[model samples]
Target chain A: MKLRFRDSMNWLHTWSCVVLGCLLFAVFLTGTLAYFQYEITHWMQPEVEQIQHKDKAINQAQAYLNTHTENAPRWTIVPPNERFSPIVAYWRDKNTTGRFSVARLDEQGNEINSRATRGGEFLYRFHFDLHYMPVFYARWLVGIAAMLMLVGIITGIVVHKKIFKDFFTLQFNKGAKSWLNSHTVCSVLALPFHIMITYTGIVTLMLMYFSWAMNMGDGDRRSFFSAFSDQAPALKASGEKAQLLPLGDIYNSAKAQLGHAGIGSIIVSNPGDSNAMVEVYENATEELTSDYRTLRYHGVTGELLHDSGVTNAAEQTRRTMISLHAGRFADTSLRWLYFLSGIMGTAMVGTGLLLWSNKRKQKMNPRFRIGYKIMDVTNLASIIGLPLAISGYFAANRLLPLQLESRAEWEIHCFFIVWLMAFVYPILRGCKHSWQELSFITGVSYLALPVISIFTTSRHILNYQFERDATLLFMDLLLFFTGGLFIYIAYIVWRKGYEPAVIARPKRPPRGVVQ
Target chain B: MTIKAFLQAISNAKGMQILWRVVLASVLGFIFLSVFIAGVASLGSALFHLSKATLMLWLMLIGIVLYCCLVMWIFASNKLMRCSVIIIAGIVISSAALYAGDMLHKNHQPVESR
Candidate 1:
C-alpha cells in the first residue's frame, strides 16, 4: 500500500530507535559528561595543585627529566592548561617496562602519586570506544549509533506536526501523551544542537564504519595526516653525541616565532644527539580549527627548521567540524552550554524510547506478553542502569585502595559490575516497582560519593576554596545536584504510578497510510 | 509449521520485505558507498588537479552525509530491485574506472616501480 513520506518516516523513526535507542542514550549521557573531562580529572587527582607560572612548570619539568632520564632518547611532555590537572611525561628507554615510562608531575614538576583512576578520560573514550570490546568493534558500534541518532532526528522532524505549538504544550501525568509531549519539548528545544552534534560526531570517525573506503584510496595514509606535522622526515639518531640546549630556551624561541602562548605539547626526538629535533605543538584553543600547528626546531642549535599551519578551505572545514564536535576550543561558559544540550539530547532519547514502549503496550492492552516484559526490563536497565554505573565509577575512585594493583582498570570493572546489577535488580523486582527503587539506590549512591571522598582524600567539599579549588568544589556540587535530581525522578515515578495505569491506544489512521 | 507454511508466511511479504531492506541497506549499502567514494575521488582527480591528500580531506568528511542520504533513500523508497540494481551497477562502473586510471598511471610512470 502507498503511504505518505511522513508516515513512512514515523515507522522508520520508531523501529530505528527501538533497535538503537539504548546505545544512543549511553553515548549521549557519557559524551555530555565528557565536556567537563578536564575538570573531572582535576577533581579525581587533587594532589596535582594549580601552577602559578606555566613556563616555569615547563622549565622545571625539563630539568627534572634531564637529571632523571638522561640516557632516554625521546621525551614528550603534555603541559597542563587552564584545567590545572597534573602534567604527563613520557620517555622511551630500553630498560623500562614496556619499553617506556609515564609519570604524573605536580606544579613543581616533582613526581606525584595521584590516586590511580582513569577518571573522566575513561568516560570520554567510553562514549565512542566502549568497554570489554575491541576498539575496531567499539568504534563501529558507536558509528552506527550516531547514524541511528541522525536518522531518528530527521525522521522525527518529518513526522512531527504543529512543531511550534507542540514545543509550548506539555500535559503532565497524561500517560502516553505526557511522554510524547516531554519528548517533543526536549527535541525541539535543542534541535540545532542535536543535528550539528550527530553530523559532526559521525564525521569525526566515519572511516572506521566505512572501512571499505580505505580500500578505495590510492595514496599513502601519512599524506592525509601530514597536515598535523610539517617536520621533514624526523631527524634520526646520529652516532655522534652533543649537549642539548635547555628546553626552556627552545620554548621561548618557539613562542617568539609563533607569537602564540598556547603551547600544547613538546616532543624531542633523539635527545643528546647531533640531529636532535624539538617539535613544539600549538594548542590553538583560541582558533576555530583544531589544526596541529607544529614548529620543528634544531634541538642542539635552537634553529627554526619548519613550521606547518596553513591549509586549504576543505581541510579548514574538516578541522572546524571536528573541533566543533569536540568543543575543546570552547571556554567554560560555552562548554556548559554544550553539556546542557547533551543532557537534553539524553532526555529526549529516553522519553522517545519510553513513548515507543508505552504506545506498544497500549495497543496490546490486557495481554502483557513476555516480549513486552523483556522490553520493559531493557528500558529500565538502559535508562537507570547507566547512571547507576557512572555513580559506581565515582564511588570506586574513593573506596578502592589507593595502591591497588591496576587500580584504574578495577574502577571500570566496578562500573560494569554495577551496570550488570542494574539489569538484574529490575528483572528480580519486576519493572513496575524497579524504577523507583533503582533510581533511589542510584540517587543515594551519587549523594554518598562526595561524603566518601571527604574521608578518603585530604580535602572535603566545604574545605575547598572556590577560586583555588573550583574543579574540586564543582565536582562535589555536581554530584549533589545529580543525586538530588535522581531522587526527584524517583519521587515523580512513585507519585505518577510507574508503568502508566491506563493509556488510550492511538486511533487507526486513514486508508493508504500505515500507522 | 511445515517449510511450505513458513515460506507462505514469509511470502505474506511484510516480514521478508523488511529483512530484504536490512540486507540492502547494510551490506550492499556499504559496497555502494565504497564505490561512490572511489568514483567521486577518481572524477575529482580527473577534473580538479588536487592532491590525493586534499581530495581525501573532503571525500571522507562529506562521505558521511552521502552515506546517510543513501540509507534514507533506500528505506524511503519501496522499489527494492531498482535499488539493488543501481548499487551493483555503480560498483562495477566505478571499479572499471579506477582500474583504467591505474593502467594509465603505469603507462606514464613505467620506470618508477610500484
Candidate 2:
C-alpha cells in the first residue's frame, strides 16, 4: 500500500509538472531577471548617465516640476537609487485622466531626451502580466499554473523518499537517469526558495484568487485594502489657492521623523491649494515588512498632519510575506542570491520537462508517436525558444530606429513575434534540428548585443565612460557569459546529438498491482 | 522494468483505472478541496470573532499546502469510492456550517431604517 501510494504521488508529480511546465519556466525566468529590472532599465536608457549627488535629487526634481508642471495638481518624485540613476518625476493636471506624464531628469535637473523604450519594465511586467492578452486572463492562467506547481512540488517531495540521500547524486551521461538527476539536483538545491517563491507568489495575488472570501465580509475591496494598509484618508482639494511652502522644509521634517529609514517617494497633492498635502514614503529596506512608514504635512502651512504608526501583528505578517516574495529589501549580494535561486527554479522546470520526454522516448516505438512528437516540439520551444525570444527583445532595442513612434510598444511586439516564430519553427523542422538552430541564434544574438551597443550608443562596454558604470559593465559581462553558455550547449548538441545512449538495465518484476 | 513490460503494464485495464483516478484527483479533487477549505475558513472566521480579512489571508496562505495534502490523500486512499464519499461529506458539512454562521450573524445585526 505504501509503495502504491508513492507511485501515485510520482505519477501526480510528473503529469502536473509536464502540463504547466512551460508557463512556469517563463514565469521563473522572467521573475529571476526582474531582480535586476531597474539595473537593466538603466542600462537600456544610456542617455541618462549615473550621477553622484543623490541627496539633492528631491530639490532638483521639485525645481523641474515647478518649471514644467506649474499648473499640475499632483506631482510624484522618485529619487535616484542604487539600481536606477534618473530622478523620475511625473505629474497629472486637475482634469486629466489615465496615467501621469513623466519626465526623467539628471542630477542637474536637466531633462534627458532619452529614446522611447519600455526598457526592463517590459520584462518585469511580462513576468506576471503576460503580453498579447488582457492582464486579467493572464493572471488567472498564471495563478492556476502556480497552484499546479505547488502540488507538483509537494508530491515530488513525497515520491522521493531518499531526497536527502540523493541530494548530491547527479550522475551524468546516463540518459534518463542523467535528466532525472539534474532535475533532482536543481529542485533540491533551491527547494526552500521554490516553496517560498511559489507560496508567496500566490499570496501576492490573494485578493484575486480568493475574492469570494472578501465578498463574504461586510466591507468592499477598497475598505478592505484601507484596513489592511491602515492608510490615512485623503483630503479633498479646496478651490481657494494658497502660497505653497517650500518642499525642502517638508522633506527635512520627514527626514527628521524617519531617522535611519531612507525616503522612497515624495507625493504632493493639490500642489497650489490650501488643502494641499505632501506625503513622504520611507523605504523599508532594512525591515522584512513592506509597510512604508509615511509622514504627511500640510503643503501651505508646512505643519505635519499624519504619521503612520506601527502596524499591527497581522498586517505586519502579511506585509512581510509580500516583502519576502518581492525581495525589494534585498541589497546587491542578497539580490544575487535570490537571482541564483530563481535560476535554479527555472532549471528545475526545464529539466523536469526534458525528463518526461526522455522517459517516454525510451519506451515508445522508434517511429515518433503523436504524444512524443508533441512533447518534443514543446520542450524545444519552451526550453530553448523562449530564451531566444528574450534575446531578440534586447536586439530589437538596439536595432530599432530611435525616433520611431510607439517604440516601446514596438519592442514588446518584437518580443512576441520572435517568440511565436520560435514556437512555430520546431513544428516545421524536426525537433533536434530546430533546437540546434534556435540555440545558435540565441547565442549569436546575445553575443552581438555588446557590439551593437558599441556601434549605436555611447554606453557600450568598450567605451571609456562605461568603465565607471559598473552596472552597465556587469550587464555586458553577464550577457557575454549567457551567450557563451548557449553556444557551448549548441555545440554539445551538434556533436553528441540530443539523446543520450540508452543504457541496458536488468528487468525486475512489476510493482504491486494497481488499485 | 523493461520498456516493453512497463508500457504494457500502463496500457492494461488496471493501469487505465489508476490513470483516471489521478485525473480525478488533479481536477475535480482539487476544486472540491478548495471549496471545502473556503467554507471551513469562513466558518472559523465567524466563530472566532476574527476579522474576515485577517482570517481569510491566513487561510489563503496555507490553502496551497492543504490542497496538496488533499491530492496526496486522494491518491493514497485504498478505495476510491470511500475517498470520494469523505470529500463530498466534508464539502456538505462545511458548507452547512458556513451558511448557519452567516445566518446567525445576520440575525444579530441591528436592522437599519431604509
Candidate 3:
C-alpha cells in the first residue's frame, strides 16, 4: 500500500476523533438541550406555568425588596417574561459574606415562593459543570477534547476530498455502507455548525488560558475589558445612613428612554444610599438588542444617570455566538434545527468511535482486548448510560422520600451510583453482553420515567392534556421516543450478534522484506 | 524488483498496517478508558474519602506510565535491553511522583480543612 501524508493525517483524524468522541458527544447533546433550559424548567414545574401577569410580577418584586431588603447591599431582580411565571429577586446582605437570597415576586413586588428553583438552569450548568468533576477542571478537560476535535474536523475534511460533492448523499439500505453514508451526510450537512460550536466553545474560555494575549495587547485586564465594553463608572455615595426610594420611577424612566422595550431586570446598587444606581435591562420581545441593553438611573432621585447603546458590533457578534450556542433567541422550528444538528454532531463522534473499535479488534492481543472492552463499557456508559441516569435522577426526585435526610444529595447520588454500575458492568460481563444488557436497561428505565412521574406527581398526562400544558406533554412524549430509540438499537445489536467485526485487515508486506 | 522482494514487500506492508491499527486502537481505547475511570473515581472518592486529590494523583501516574508504554510499542525499535529499561524507569518515576503528591496533600489536609 502506498502511504500519503494526507492518508496519514486522515488516519490521525480518525483516531483522534475516535479517542475523544464520547466526550464530544456528551458535550454536544447536553449543550443543545441546555439551549432551551428555561422552557424545560417551565415544562417541569407545571404550577408556575404562565401564572403571573408581567406588570404585577414586577410590582411584586419591588414591594418585596422594599419590605425585606430596603437597606441590603445590592438587589437584583429578574422580572417575569412570556415564557416564565415567577418573578425572581436575588440579594446579598452587607454583613453576610458571599451569601445571596433568592425569592419569587408578584406584580406588587411582594415575595412569592422563595424555594421554586431555576429549573433548566441546573441542566444548563450541568453541561459545563459535568457530574463528579470540579467545574474549572471539567471545562479545561472539555476544552482540550474540543481542540482535539477541531484537529479531527480539519483532517477529516482534507481526507474526504469528495465530501462536498456527495454532501447530500444518504443511503439507507446497504448495512455498514449505509451507516457510513448517513454519518457523512449528517456531518457534512451541518459542517458549519459543528465548526462554529467547537470554535466558540474554546473561545468562551479563551481568557482563562490565554489572558496573556490580552495583557500583551493591553497593559492591564481592566483596560482590556474596557476596550471592548463601555461599562459606566459606578456612582459613589457617603454616609451609612440612607433612605428608601420608589423603584417605579426608575423603572418607568428606563422604559421611556429605551422605547417599547419592557424592563426584564433591574439591579439597584447601594439601594438606600444617595448615589444608588438602578440599572434596568430591557425585556426580550421589543428589540433584538433588548437582551443586551442597559439603562442606568439614580435610584435615590429617580433621575436618569447614563444609558449604554444596545450593543457594539463586537458585542453583538459575541452575543449572537452565545445566542446560537444557547438557542435562547430561536423559535420552535429553529430550536429543532439546533437539536438535529446537535444529534448529528453526537452521531458523528459515536460512529467515529465505533469505526475505531471495529478497525482495531482484528489484530489486538488478549491483554489489549481488555483495554478495548473498557472502552466499549465507557462508550455505552456515557453515550447510552447518562441520559438514562438523568431520567433516574428526575424519577428519584418524584419517588424518593422527601423527608429523607439530604434528599437532594441522595437523588443525585442515585444517578451517579447507577451510572457507576453501568460503567463497571460492561467491564465485568465483557463488552457484548454489557452492551445488549444495558441498552435494554436504559430503554426500560427511560420508558418508565413518565409513568413514574404520573404516579408520583399529582398531575397526569391526561390532566396536563386537559389543562393544555403542551410543554409537559411534549417532554413526556420525547422520553417515550427516546426509549423507543434505545430499544431499536438494542434489537439491532441482538440481531447482529456481538462479536468481532467481519472486515478483514488489509494484506501487504514491508518495502524490503522477503516473502 | 525481484518476485521474492515484491512478495516480501506485500506481506510486510500488510503486517505494518495491521500493527498500526491495533496500536492506534489500544492507545486511544486505553486513553479514554483511563480518563473515564479517573473521572468516575474522582467523584465517588470525593464524597467517600472527603478528598479526590489522591485519586487524581494515582490516575495521572498510571496515565504517564501507560503513555510511555504505548510510545515504546509504537516507536521504539529495539526489542532487547532498551525496552525493559525504559519501561522500568517510567514506572519508577511515575510511582515516585504519585507518592510525593499524596504525602504532600495529606500533610496539608488540616490547613485546607480549617
Candidate 4:
C-alpha cells in the first residue's frame, strides 16, 4: 500500500505510543506529582509541617547527634525545612549493623522516637522503579518509552500542520477532534521543554550504559568524574585535631558568601578525624541548573580553608540541564509552568492511548476485543486511579492512628492497596462504568482529603489561612480544584452516557486501507 | 531544483533517509539494553562501580538520534525506513550482547600482579 508520509507517521505515532502508553501514563502522572514532592512530604508529616527557625532546627539536630554518636566520622543533616514534616538526620555509623542510620530529631535537637518514613520517596521510586520488575529493567523500560514518546511528539507536530495556529483552540464540544486538538496544543506549547526533559532525563545518567568511554579515558573513574567536575580541586580533610564547630556558623558563612542563593544541603565531614571538614553547597535560585557555592572549613578548628562556587561554564551548563529536568531551581510560578506543561504532555499521551483503544474497538474479533478491554482497564488505573491512590495516602496519614507503631508504612500501603483494587475493579465492572465511577470516586476522595485534614488537625484550612502557611493552604486548594476537575469529568461521563453505550462501531475503511 | 527534486534529493542521498533511522534506533536500543545489563551486574558492588551519569548520557544520545531519524523517516519511503530500522536495531542488540559478555568475562578475570 502506498501511504502518504503524514499517514505513515500517523500510523507510527499511534502504534509506538500505544505500545508503552500505560507506562508513560504512570511516569507522567507520578513525575508531575514529584514536582511537588517535598510539599507532599510536608503535607504527610503534619508535625513538622511548618518549621521555623531552621538554624535552631539544625542546631537541635546537631546537639542530639553530638550526644548520641560523636565518634561517627561523617554527619549529614537535612534540617527540617518548610516542605517536610520531620527533622531527621541521616548518618554513617561504623558501629551500627548498617552503615547508614536515620533518626528523627526533637525540637531541642534531640533524637525522637520516630521511624524513617519514606513518604514521597515511595512515589518517586515507584515512578521509575515500577512493579514486578528490577529497578534497572524498569529504568531501561522507561527510557525506551521516553524515547518513543519523543518520536510521538515529533511526528505529532509534523502531522498537525496547524499545531501553532491552533494553540489557543480547544473545542470541547467536538468529540475526538477536540481531544486531539487540546492534546496537540498542550504538546506543542512546551515541545522543546518536553524533548529536552525526556532527553536530559536520559543523559544525566549516561555512563551507566556506555562504559567504552570510561575505557577510552584514564583507568580511574574518579579522575574522569573530576574532569566533568570542571577541574575543581578535590576536597581533602584538614589534618588537625579540633572540636566540632556549631552548624550555625557554617550556615551564616554560606549565606554571606552566596547571598540569596538557595541552600541545598549541609555536610560536616570527618567530624572526629584529625582533619575533619565542613562543606556546604548553596543551590542557585534562578537558573535551571546548579551553580553552587562551596565552603570547606576545618571541622574542629572552625577555620575556613578553601571556598569554591560553581563557576565553570561546563558545570553551570550541566546544572542548568539538571535543574530544568528536576524543576528544583524554579520558583512557584515557574513550577506552575512546569506543571501545566506536564499536564499537557499527560493529556497528549492519554488521548493518544484512548484513540488507540477507540480505534481497536471497531474490530469484532474476541481476542482483539479482550485486548482492547484490558487496555481500557489499565488506562483507568494509570490515569485516574493512581492519583486517587495518592490522595488517599495523604488522607490516611492524618486519619490513621498516629500512635500506631507503623503508621507511616500503613498509610503508604493503603495507597498501593487502593490502586490494586482500582486495577481489579475495572476488570470486573467493564470499562465505561468503571471510568465514570472511578472518576467520581477519585473526585470525592481528593475533595475529602482537605476536609479530613481540617477535622483531624488543630491547624485546619482556616487555621492555615490565619497562620499564613501558604504551602499547606495551596496544597488543600490544589486538592479541592483537582476534585472539581474530576467531578466535571464525572458529569461529562453522565451527560454523554457511558462511552461503551454510545460508541457505534465504525464501518470498514474502503478496501484499499485494511485488507 | 524544483520542490519535488529537492524532496527526491533528500530521499536519495547515501543512507540519507533510512540509514539515519536505523542508526538512531540501534544506538537507542543499545543504550537502553546496556544500561539495564550494567546496572544489574553491578548490584551489591562498591558504590564507585555505579555510573548512572554515563547511562543517562547514552540514553539521551539515543533520544537525540531517534528524533533525527524520525524527521528523516517522515520524508522517506516507509518500507525502506522500516527495513533499515530493523537492521540497525539488530546490530545494536548484538553489540550490547557482546559487550555484556565481555563485561562478565572481565569481571571474572583474576587480578594478575608481580
Q: Best by TM-score, which number?
A: 1
Displacement of residue A203 (Cα, Å) in model 3 is 2.5
Q: Which residue pairs in candidate 1 have backbone atoms (N, alpha carbon, C) closer than 3 angstroms, thus clashing?
A: none
- In candidate 4 chain A, where is summed lDDT lowest over 10 consecutive residues? A209-218
lDDT of 4 by residue, A1-515 (tens): 25688886776677567878988988887888788887776666555535567777777777777777845777877655444545667787766666477787756675554433566777777766776568778887887787677777667777777888887666776766766676776677778877887766656545543454343222345654664443334345555555677787777776787776677777877775556777777665556555576777776667777767666454455566667788777778888888887877787778777766666665545535556667778888888888888877877777777677777678778888888989999888877688889999999998998888877777668677545567778888999999999999988888888657234455678877966
| Each model's fraction of native contacts | 0.47, 0.37, 0.00, 0.10
lDDT string, candidate 1, A33-55, tens digits: 99898888777777667776766
Worst 10 residues of 2 chain A by lDDT: A500-509
TM-score of chain A for the candidates in order shown: 0.91, 0.90, 0.86, 0.88
TM-score of 4: 0.79
Candidate 1: true interface contacts recovered: 0.47
* C-alpha lDDT (0 to 100) for residue A469 of candidate 1: 82
Q: Where does candidate 3 chain B have its weakest 10-residue lDDT segment?
A: B72-81
The TM-score between candidate 2 and the true structure equals: 0.87
Error of 1 at A5 (Å): 2.0
Question: Whole-model lDDT, candidate 1?
Answer: 0.80
Which lDDT tens digits does candidate 2 get at residues A175-220? 6787888888998989999999998888788678666555544336
By TM-score, highest first, what's the ranking? 1, 2, 4, 3
Model 2 chain B poorest 10 in a row by lDDT: B30-39
Candidate 1 CAPRI grade: acceptable
lDDT of each: 0.80, 0.79, 0.64, 0.68
Stretches of model 2 off by over 4 angstroms after superposition: A1-3, A51-55, A63-73, A90-100, A108-111, A262-264, A365-368, A465-467, A499-515, B1-46, B107-114
lDDT of 3 by residue, A91-122 (tens): 97777767598776555555544223445665
In model 4, the Cα lDDT at residue A200 comes to 65
Candidate with more favorable, higher lDDT: 2 or 3:
2
DockQ result, candidate 3: 0.02
